[model samples]
Target: MDEQQRLAYWRANTALIRNLLIVWALVSLVFSILLVETLNKIQFFGVPFGFWMAQQGSILVFVVLIFIYAFQMDKLDQKYNNKK
Candidate 1:
């Protein structure tokens, strides 16, 4: 890849990472902590939503995010001719 392609690839990569991090923070911090009181008003299965988020929701989201990152990065790699 030339200089321009390299720069664009890195930019796209960083943007993907940034967006994923934002989602991670929103799920792990905002939903599980800041919005706990409001979320608790709702129920997930038999448990309170807030309690579920703190106990399991965040972990589930994290795992899903990992898969999403891997999937997206694979596409990104193909786009940049960087596939393994």
Candidate 2:
């Protein structure tokens, strides 16, 4: 790829990463800690939502985010002609 194409690809990749990181942080930190009191007022599958998030929900969200990131990055790669 040309220099411009490389730069574009890098920028796209960085943006994708940034978005995914934000989601991860929100799930792992905000849902599990900052919003725990409010979330605990609700129940999910018989467990407090905040407790679930602290124990398992964040993990599940992280896994899902990984998949989403991979899928989006694949599209970005194709868009930038950087696919392997």
Candidate 3:
């Protein structure tokens, strides 16, 4: 890739990473910690929603995000002719 192409790819990759990190932070910090109390008012599978989020929801979200990132990056790679 040319220098300009490399720079564009880098910027696109950075943007994707930044967006995913934001989602991760929202799930891990906001839902698991900050909103735990309010979420606990709801129940799922006999467990408090907040407790579930703290224990499992964030993990699930992270896994999902990983898949999403991989899928998106594949498209990005194709767009940039970097796919292998």
Q: Which candidate is the best by TM-score?
A: 1
Candidate 1, lDDT over the whole model: 0.94
Give the per-residue lDDT digits (tens) of candidate 3, residues 10-77: 99999999999999999999999999999999998999999999999999999999999999999999
Measured over all alpha carbons after superposition, the RMSD of each candidate to the real structure, in angstroms, is 0.9, 1.2, 1.1
The lDDT, on a scale of 0 to 1, for candidate 2 is 0.91
Each candidate's number of clashing pairs is 0, 0, 0
The Cα error of candidate 1 at residue 30, in Å, is: 0.6
Model 1 ranges off by over 4 Å: none
Q: How far does residue 14 in candidate 3 sit from its true spot (Å)?
A: 0.5
> Candidate 1 vs candidate 2: which has greater lDDT?
1
TM-score of each: 0.95, 0.91, 0.92
Better of 1 and 3 by TM-score: 1
Worst 10 residues of 3 by lDDT: 75-84
Q: For model 2, what is the alpha-carbon lDDT of residue 43? A: 93
TM-score of 2: 0.91
Q: Per-residue lDDT for 1-84 in model 1, tens only?
A: 899999999999899999999999999889999999999999899999999999999999999999999999999999899855
